[model samples]
Target: MSRRPPDGEAPVVTAIVVAFDSAHALPDCLDALRGEGIATIVVDNASTDDSAALSERRGARVIRNGRNEGYGRANNTGVRAADTEFVLIVNPDVIVQKGAVAALVDAAQRYPDAGFFAPQIVEPSGRVFFQPRSLLAKHLTNPGGKLVLPEGEACAPFFSGACFLMRRSFFLDLGGFDEKIFLFYEDDDLCRRIADTGAALIYVPQARVGHGRGRSSGPKPGLVFKSRWHQAWSRAYVSRKYGLPDPAPSMFAVNALKTLAAGLSFRRSLIERYGGSAAGALAFLRGRSALRQEGLS
Candidate 1:
């Protein structure tokens, strides 16, 4: 039986934090959720640290998995356990400002048609990261600075899943993230799937969340490599799924060019990494390699 939130109670908002060795970020994340009076769910993916215990101590309902499940799978696990009407899937590294959660929930409510809603995303330094927007304009604009779209402009190219909230029913109906995409493109895939069902993803400028950039990736080179590798592989998967213009052949060609350029540029490290990745990409393009899989979470 499904657990139902009491009528007239603040719509139960389940904030799902998927943690994998994220001891440092967990407390801040849990505190933000509890501060907002949002029910918190922490899904620990086999953290070597005392992450699970810490989350429980902080009053978050904890779910422990013996093995590391990649991002998508871990999130799905949390979503499945939630009993809320609205679900806010957040990264452990994000800090919710006062009223951010309420604003997101209100935006979703007001925009009834929107499948997902998120606020302006920013770095800890108060600089705006690219909030969700159409692909063309997003790429055309410079990376930093506030991007205010003109009235009637396309608001969303895709939903920003990193710190967005969605209706629980709509989220589950879409079957959650594509498990095949272990990392990067899973968010894009989810947005596309929502669009396929004719639901829009809205950006609520009123809401705001501060993200610590690369909190998981920056200090760890191996994890960074895995992230980039998964990105390349998931790009192929997205291209295949959404019928985006064929990027494999071009990506392979570009990687080959980069490998040569790196070698000529006297960047030995770049050459080593790009050369191997390019070789794998070429093999993929030629049907000589298997579809890349996500590493254990």
Candidate 2:
């Protein structure tokens, strides 16, 4: 990520863009930021393409990584470089609609106690992305009663990191994101940590961003295995971190059963698609091993 001196004299919001070979969809995103009173920084994670040059030409301060650092680390670099009161962490493949950025800034003021906040995240197909909280938050009590979907009208436990605004100091103090996370589950981990600090994580219904879903995960059996494996690992980590007070062993047992069943089903899909039952089984085994290697069990 790039670093810059915060302009002490004026109120300037710095928008941090984390990109990895993200040239195709950047122009429309930059166009949306036109006239927005915010300085922009783009951290290119070792893109072999012209993404860095394009970002620089589009008036964004660009930082080029030597190789593809994982997502959390790249964003952490941007957070360290932030010099403004707030940092807007936006993904390269997302497009911010009108007033979305401003709405997030205003949300910080409206919910003064919230440490992290996100806008309504809509996929390109208009489906809302509901990144679930830890197992305790989801069950512990009931199913979907306390949970708010589509748009959250109140303080939420977790906020999607795809597009969100957060105070720089608070974000820094919370230690940003866990670099251990390669891709999936970083956002949920951050939100869980922030909420543990007694700082609310809120959702601003007015703010909105459109996501080209699965930009990082290509539509392939390997991608599915890897993504699901990582997510399962992260969920276990979060649960272990926060769900200790509860009957965690029992809860984990329940989830483990479900995950095992799902894994079996997914492995069958892999066998059918790849036409190599042995290789597919091996890939599935690797996915399960990844979860275990990450200490999920």
lDDT of 2 by residue, 1-297 (tens): 112335656554688888876787777666566446457788888886778898888888888888767678788898888788888898887787877877888778887788987888889777777654544453223354454474355666666778888899998988888876656668877876787778887778788788886573224445454455455455545555665442323434554555556567776554333332222234333444332433433
Compute the lDDT for candidate 2: 0.67
Residue 169 in candidate 2 has what lDDT?
Answer: 91
TM-score, cand. 1: 0.82
**Model 2 residue-pair collision total:** 0
Worst 10 residues of 2 by lDDT: 272-281
Residue 117 of model 1, lDDT score: 80
Cα error, residue 100 of model 1, in Å, equals 1.0
Per-residue lDDT tens digits for candidate 1, residues 1-297, read 012237775546888888888888877877877877778888898888878999999998999998777788889989999988889998888878778888887777778887988677788887776643433232323445346643331347564667989888889899997775566677877876787777877777777788886674224445544554555666776676665665667767787798899878898677656665665456446554222343342
lDDT per model vs. reference: 0.72, 0.67
